[model samples]
Target: MSMTEAQTTTRKQALGSPLDRADGRLKIQGLATYAIEKSLENMAYAVVVQSTIPHGRIRSMNIERARQSPGILAVYNHHSGLIIHPAKTFGQGGAAAQAFLPLQDDKVLWNGQHIALVVAETLEQATEAAALIETEYEQQAAIVHPDNPDARPETVDALTIEWGDAVPALAQAEVQIGGVYTTPREYNSPIEPHGCIAHWQDGSLTLWEPSQWVGGARQVVSEWMAIDREKVRVISPYVGGGFGCKGGIQPHSALACVAARELKRPVKLALTRPQTFTAFGGRPRTHQQLALGASRDGTLQSIVHDSWNETALNDVHKEPCNAVTPLMYASPNFLSHHKLIHLNTVNPSWMRAPGENPSAFALEVAMDELAWALKMDPLALRLKNYAEQDPQAKIPWSSRQLREAYQQGADAFGWSKRPLEPRSLREGRQLIGWGMASGTYPVRRTPGEAQIVLYADGRLEVQSSGVDIGTGTYTILAQTAADVLLVAPESITVLLGDTLLPRAPVAGGSQLANLLTGAVHKTALALRDMLITLAVSTEKSPLWQQSPAALALADGFLWLSDKPNLRVSFSELLRLSGNDKLIAHQDTFATTASEDDRNKADSTSSMMVPPTEGGVSAHSWSAIFVEVAVDEDFGTVRVKRMVGAFDSGRIYNPKLTESQWIGGMVMGIGQALLEEGAIDDRDGRITNANLADYLVAVNADIPELTTIDVGKPDYLATVLGGKAVGELGIVGVAAAISNAVWHATGKRIRDLPITQDKLL
Candidate 1:
């Protein structure tokens, strides 16, 4: 079958069906409980006090006023001697977004640093008393931007990739395109803010919070409170949204725990709108330089990409903006390097797509410039440099259909009608243009475990510590289990985001579906095999000596495929065997890893790197086509429409997958034309800290959007034969929109947020 054709499997396949979210009713009716809503008896509200100075040391703190305020239970500051330890940073294989623990001392690292906490009987009282707590500070000069003279950048050797020399290759090439591109600092801005409720009872702590990794959060809290790991229980069944900010433990969780322990009662702390912007990390500002060399025939010969991003003074978080340059296209000589600029800012965390999102904007736009320079079609140019295998690893891909995606997307978007010349197509006051770009993201899988139980009454239960994060975890897992047992999805119940469940990894990097689906599928199969053994061994069962391969299980009945009349219900079989339930557990590893990788992960608590088979690479691919209408007078750009074709192996649920794609594309539109987290240089404070000021793509900004799924199942990638699609949808969208703007106005804007001022 052609790789371009989407799988024609029906609901019976269970993997590619467009199943509705199982938790839809509960969520729509507001019955689903969130972190802050997990109220406990006699819960006291806690409000965090932030430092006004970016860099400072507390000279003195006066909590007497707060202590005398109405309904005030207690007020604590740095001198309160809170028993908290800094968690291991996420990059170091622990749960914290930043390694720095706040409130340990008087030295303030940045503006909005948690200086104190006020506990009151009500939220309003806590907020009022928190404002009354005063503090004097001794300020120091701070460096908040990379452009500052005091800023010093350090080269990251681990992220650097060098192959054949690119400088000499570029100079001798038949054509070259070089330019600087930049993207501003952006926040996650999830619908739900980061919050937590901490309760300590019977020498055990229970935390209700929004987290992408409940297990990791439990570990962090246990380590910080000096409690046993088993004594810490984290529960987050439903999260409003968590792009990446809530993926790990934040300082607020620690503070809430401390307050609860000190006051001997449950403590609730929910970050305010402005506090959400200041308390958590976001995508750092990036400056990238890209140069591409190609032959006169539009074949890429050399590529050089160097990038720099801001980081906190103490925490070094570098953005690998050039990571996609080596993976996207085929080039004989390439150089990709990264650097980190130390500044007084919130340490950056993973946003949707993280490095790849900004990286593709620069790389793809550069490719578009090269295509224009060569007087060639953009899509044709990409085809000429298409990578048949991993250019660096020199191996075959597990499954790749990027070329087919381009072809299908182009046909649907009417790319053949796009004029070759820029600013040629016009409609009244609008200059119309169409542009396209290719996107790619690596497919990585980690270790996960699951548990499944089946009762004689035909009830199925699946449990895992993985989180939904609004990606339809409940629905997909049900489908996967139903596929194996030949049961209806409604009969299966999925429980997730609890420490009591089986172990699972963080729900980032698009790995949850790849890991959990495999776990459920394998566990369900194991249960089936166990039941088949019981039936074959018992003489009371019909066709006791029947071969397992010749029998099929469906709707809680076991029968011979060739003799349907000879059937046995699961309840009857269990009753005869004097068993009430059947249970199975499975540990899943999506990829094979070497001993060294395993040892490294074990020793450093870092993520495991799975070695490929012989030399194979796995990646999800997409082709994005966009149309934009540029106003001739106002210089404003409006996206007319967008179409994306994706090759992500077998899409587990088309409805959820398309939602993710459309959401990503909308974020991309914001990145290209609206979003920016402005900062006050003097105080290292965010100027636009609220949603009203921080522009995002609203319903009015998004035009008609369409997505196409195309690919065959890739067994080589994983047992489920599905790659990660969470990050792939947003990879090259900014570049496609930027390219469209250029095509419409003949003006190339390298900087992001192509505002009307830049165009005018």
Candidate 2:
């Protein structure tokens, strides 16, 4: 059955219910069109040739043989004079993941940099031609890792947070615990891989790509092509999965656009799996040193955290691993700073929770160690140090239920029955243990517009330029409108991920649902008001002469709240008013993009306005509990179960929220026991560039999972009351798993992916 048909058959209520995804049917039936699937007339195929050396300058290129090959249309190199301008980096409020444009110069900044693009009549021809091209490079010695002696670490002043003298406080503390933690580079291996098709016609350009930020992608292409923004259109209705890889405009996109414009024919380019590892940014390798000082009674005295993560030499994108330190706990003295280490690798981008994931691992592990030293339960230690307010921002929490989350998760996980000492619980040859950790992510919302239309035929349409990224954005939009209009969800149609729709922020930072829903809510309310006005003005309608306040809508009918007999169907009201549909548009949570606010820029024609500032700090909190079993001889560790209690503030869909949390927990399992991107130091190339070499959690790796919502409405944060939920699930997951391993073996594994070798 179709998604709408299924919902109608089941008679499911909208909003906060376990409603199936609105796009589930289309996806399963292969009817959903993703980027690169959009077929065009006379479309040509393009393939990329990458640099072999870590860093160098192209000396010579031999493209004669490839050009002579059958079906080859064109081969573009740095000398091709491809007319594409440079764009600001995503960090600088532009769409590009990195500032340095590829195939623009002879200089090679990193291994696997796109050196050339070959276009052909067919995919096979393009692939063959791309492989036939050869080049010589003048190689240079490269610093490939943060640990390299020649690598210099530059501290980011904006990331530094300091209040009191933490060093002195640590020295005078009654007890202190500290540790160094490291996480290897990680790749965002989305199932569909990144690809794009660029088509130009009638002085306008259209791009079909799996972009997490459709509006931002359009804006970037317009700036790079030096054309009017109106001349560029980005259509990305479905994305297999983004996880930050497709969050920004990558080089291949620009390459495809340039090739299409130059050749005057549509060009399609899809990166191979290995190319994905280098073509786009991934999570940077992080090195963190975290220290905590506390009193004998487990009261936190000081917190000091210093961290460095790898960034490309061509672009600076530091992984601020110290970001969560100050907000994690209340301390009399605090010091946290972040530094970027230049490496001959691709510029790193946000992966999942980005800063919060790695930072939470270090901080939570240190908290576990401190708990061991204080002879207190890890959960107890966390509860003792929980900040009632945002310690760093010096503001009250808009809404915080972390304490409730802890209590609820602990009760659900049966924490009271667990033995305190390591290796105390065993089952046959397996050593059993329990561990817990806390997680938090900031609540960020950007201004966006939503357009809603109530058709006289009793169907509703909600439109926005937002991408779902598989986070149930479609369902959220449908549910929000259905609830507001008092109509069945199946009667609503939602359009998104198109530049033709109303403007919206990029679907990143866990902000899309909150931002989009708020706009939809505002529009829905306005639409209801319009319907009421239509009914009250029509002399033939029973609702005539009634105040809007006295009118109520339910079951697709407008009626007086006091007298149910006096009612008018929406269609009847529309017909009486001689209108086919009622349309409403609203902008919500708007922000003006200053230099400081560029990260949240919205490039639509709507004059950028200031967001209503609130004094309270907003964040989503969670408490994760894990149970694990360790093999005695084989050093195999298995996560048996996990329970996560979260306070994300007004979950719009409980079913989808649970799915997001479970998926995040699975990723967390991978982070703790499997996933890592291995880079070859000699060439700065990722040794494990494909799924065969790289490891991630699969069905066999997942354990029993549970999620609890301890959220409440926080009107101060957003009118919808929902906070960010996408990245919150993975925040403390790795830490909880690592701590469970420690409890099982009494061996503290400081590094990530606690492999069997590390345990052995």
Candidate 3:
């Protein structure tokens, strides 16, 4: 699978148009309703009170003063009217939640832990009263260091993979590099904060939430409230952005529901931006060490990765930091393991690229060191060790054009003019350097259901429970329906983000486009089949008893496959059949690895099942090339230009895909040079909790960025022949920036958010 002469000339085509997003008008005009915008007729407000001390035990809480405040309704604490059960901590299901529960007991484990909920007639009153409620605590010693080398907590769910003896393999290697990489804790920071509106009437609950998975929310709320799962309805019409933060229901949602149940009125609760950092989840800080053993020719012999991450005292969250290390390159002897260390901090959940983002930074930077040691070109070294197949799955790739990605990206970057030595390609006072790294993300597929309704006026309505999250989901799904039904995209209307509709998978993991598009396509085909049967069986002036396969549909008309002129509008055919509309539903699930075997059956009955099928493991690949200039006098690193070449199978919507890729690159830039979660070791407090103190990439800091699609169609992955594109664009970006920094200055930075202090 090298970039041979014949392979370098092959070019893939784009599949769809770059038109306006289907919901663009609604979003731009401020007509789209987010979760916080939903207001019930008799809705009240609720605010949470958090603990002041980092690690402590609650002694007593005095709420009498708060109850006397203006517009105060009621304050619910540990001895409250409604009881919320506290679930197990640090287990499989519990691993997802950062905080255990709100005021389940009086034991405070971390600073900013929710202590009480205040409900009032107005939002202002709830906030004021919440501040007035004071609590006395017995403080204790706490640990907040992310780089505590000797820290190890009890293992909950740990994974270990060993192929051969790593020590002997490393000893025999000609070149070896060992270093530790650390990434700071960071928040997802979606534009809209986490919020939920809950109304309970006659033992049934209706919730308006901002969530990625409505089905999962419904289940969590049902079990937490001790009610029937069918008794709850979750509605999320639009979400600002999740980034894997809104996967399930959080404690604030339960607090809102509890307040509603106690007061017999609807309650609304939205976490403030400052509170969002503590209440909601963030990416935990990770400390990882990578030891690479390679031959003089740039071939990897063995690799060992050990990582330790921080989770909350009560809950455990572990990122698969070494997920790609074992199989990324052609390493025969490999070992990867991760452990969790509990700290008195908020629980960290999934952010963008969860496991792979930080892991790739470590692995790719180590590759750069290996290239330097062997005196080889970084791009050529990567190409030399390219894995022909997925070593982890022991299967061929569904469709991998990484070799082509490397060649095209290198040509676009002018790699031939790059100097081999660091600080050797200087221009004026700035030292210019070029570096490149390859990105990869697995293609995950799950079950999805969509229903299509053909109206009498030739309009089509597509229904699914998936969320848009400002990713142009509505437009892409509409295009898919249009392509299959042979109708104009404007004639199709998409209805989504409702639990009452047909079940769909979560919109995370870049799976929705591939999974939902296939379901919509199948449903449209089914509707077309039904329309053909109605047209042929009718006694009207048309072909009678014609086979479905022999009929062709185009421009809202049905015609015989052999005849070009003989056609009838669908409206006339349905009118003759004595029906004004037709409806069809199709439920499609990804074929798992077991589906390849005739005798095996699926293990789990859950709607979202993992793909275990024995086929080419599907994934999206990319090559990121960056140019940076180092100011040696001031220790400032400036990213001048960046270009990304991606192979995300089919390109359904070119405009939206390009936007997503560019946005991802911007985020990667932030991770490389600015973003960091600073913790105060004196009392284990997050020193910079607000947006002003903590830095993210602003418009002025961003460089000129370009995205190009290596556009290879992957028919083996799904019917649409598309892999997930959301996470892969940002995977290798940090490493590329770091490599570029090393080229500009002779300093090799292994830590993330490469600060100026490191350069000095």
Global lDDT scores for all candidate models: 0.86, 0.87, 0.79
Worst 10 residues of 3 by lDDT: 596-605
Model 3 residue 122 CA deviation in Å: 1.5
Q: Write the per-residue lDDT of candidate 3 for residues 673-760, one digit (tens) a residue.
A: 9988887776766778788987888998888898889967788877788876888888989999999999999899988888889998
| Ten-residue stretch with the least lDDT total in model 1 | 1-10
lDDT of 3: 0.79
Candidate 1 residues 653-696, lDDT tens each? 89999998888889899999998888898998998999999999
Q: Give per-residue CA lDDT, model 2, range 493-538, as digits (tens).
A: 9999998898887787788888888889889889988888888888
Best by lDDT: 2
- For model 3, the superposed segments whose C-alpha errors exceed 4 Å read 1-15, 86-99, 146-150, 153-158, 540-550, 560-566, 590-612
- lDDT order, best first, reads 2, 1, 3
Off by over 4 Å in 2: 1-12, 539-550, 560-567, 589-600, 604-613
Q: Between candidates 1 and 3, name the one with more favorable lDDT.
A: 1
